[model samples]
Target: MKTSPLEQTRFWQAQALGDIEMLHARYVQQRFAPHVHEGYVITIIESGAQRFWHRGSEHLAPVGSMVLINPDELHTGAKAHEQGWRYRGYYPDTERITGVLDELELKRCGLPIFDASVIQDPQLARAFSGLHCSAEHDASALEQQTAWREAVLMLVQRHARVRGTPLPGHEPGAVARAKELLDSLLACPPSLEQLAAEVGLSPFHFARVFRQATGLPPHAWLKQRRLGRAREMLRQDCPPLTVAFALGFSDQSHLNRQFKQAYGVTPGEYRRACSGH
Candidate 1:
């Protein structure tokens, strides 16, 4: 006798993405009643297929397809294939979408809407899928935040009819100041909004300007700075654990992974080499 595969669901908030809700689910016999979400529903079907009803129409979302539902829309969901479906979903409120558009100062009369329930853009699917994986795997806040904005911008521009606005102008002084702040607070960096406020720029605009000036987003820059500082301390024979804690890494392993990725050697090995141990 064989047992049925158990359904799995993991729901969590992406604190880095403004605490937006996310879902990763695999369903075999699960069924969603006709219901509505207070936020927009964006999902990428990873395997199998899902059948759902929305706006008096039935739709099928198979592998490599995306299901998009605007806010407050009633929809129902169940397996479209025998094996069920696995998907990663993003639930962001109207403000979250609008905020991204607002950052670029796009001239829009109202909220952007998705005219279709399902789409098959491979590039978009890859972007959003990669984003979901990054958030799930605890990617750095800077990376997550940057990816979120880019992916959302792409989604709206490609499908929702949102037009592009001019790129943000440069602000060298503000960029330098923001970097100083980030460097001073490596163990507990400020959020994007807070960092922007410190420099008199909006969060997204600051991020764009920082990227333009430094060739990296604030978070990525912070990451590099942290790794650099770790190297300095390791050269002084500091332990990996101490380096991790001092630089705001999650743990020694976290430092190990990033340090190796950057310099091709673990902190311990680097420390040994520098000290001639």
Candidate 2:
């Protein structure tokens, strides 16, 4: 007798990406009944293979391929490989897809659709996989937001046949004002939407503009500023916990991770060196 691999499933909302739902799952014995999703389903097969039923036919999705289902489509899923399949999936409503297109002012005859149920574009697969990992790990809002737009644009252009138009030109004044706002609200920074609204631009457009001008999206830029402030506080003998809370890190561990990544030293070590301890 042979043992089957254990099953695992995680479903969560990515608040950084406007609360879009995501899933990372591996299954050996599970079978999905015929169902319809009100939103679009985009999934990448990471290992093994998946056999699914859609549009009156059975389909196989091997590893490194992406399965795309448009909104309100019926589908069924099960394992096609002996060991089962592990996949990362994104469920985005019509607004999530259209919103990115609208920001670019792309001409659209109707909502974008994916005629193919599965695709073998390695670039797109890698882009979406990385985006899923970033969201799963709670990356900064700016990085996640910017990545989501770029990935969706690539998907729509390559697979969904969405044509592109030139993006809006830069607005230096708006970028400056947005930066000031972010600087002032470091402890409780505004969301992408809020920052955009304050600067009189759409959220995605504002993110683009900020990235173009600053070489970093709003949240990433804010992170650098926070780290700088953390260093200042540490030099003044502030405790690590106090610095973490004051700089809006989720916890001391969060601060430690970011600090080490940026400065190559833990917060405690930095503090000790500064205090001559």
Candidate 3:
């Protein structure tokens, strides 16, 4: 039961947004012990078969199928075939999934509890898989957000139900003020506590309100804003290093990484493309 080198298990940190986590893994002999995650788990099985225990029963997820696990649900996983199983997965916190529900204007009957453990729809499988790929890679913020929203909407409309607490209320007023601060202080952004204090809220409440309003945590929002300004500056033929300092990025490389993550091209490449040179 030793895993071969080809049997990869990669954990991807949420690079674009703080609300999601991802994995692209292939397992030959590895078996997961019973565990629970505090968020929703949507997995697309790529090959072979995976057997898992959930909700007091066992389920099989074959290739080209999607597995949906609700928040805090217990589950286990093991290969059912000799060839093993490959999958790309996303773990989005309750707030994140609910934000999508809010955007879709779905009135909250409750939390989204999936009725099906394994879904075989090719279209949904493809959509979820594509979202995973975008999230796990250096996909641009707009690209990643679009995919995330689409996938969540499909999952909720087709497979999940509202059977928990009602959704949160309106975006707080402090959130608006905090956003203004971030916009005004791009070159020297305020810390969470500092922003919270100026907005007359605690750090925790400020962060929650901000995320509930924008679908991204405060720091992630700042990064996105920085990237947006950097794109504009880069297109205007601003030097990469100069754009970095102007936008509060630490340096040229930092700017480059963020630029590439959002646009799928480096600053230099983007500038040339913009110039038609």
TM-score for each of the candidates: 0.57, 0.57, 0.58
Spell out the clash pairs found in candidate 3: 111-164, 140-262
Whole-model lDDT, model 1: 0.82
Per residue, candidate 3 scores C-alpha lDDT tens digits across 1-277 of 2436657765545556553656687887667655556578888999999999988799999999889998756677888878899998877779888888887787887688988889888988898888777766678988888887887788788887778573454447798788788988999999999999999988998888888776668887777777767766876888899999998988888877656433334678666645545
Question: Which residues of candidate 3, in runs, are more than 4 Å off?
Answer: 166-277
Encode model 2's per-residue lDDT on 116-159: one tens digit a residue: 99999999999999999998898999999999999999999999
Model 2 ranges with Cα > 4 A deviation: 1-5, 162-277
Best by TM-score: 3
Report the C-alpha displacement of residue 123, candidate 1, in angstroms: 0.5
The parts of candidate 1 lying over 4 Å away from their true place are: 1-5, 162-277
Candidate 3: residue 143 lDDT (0-100) = 89
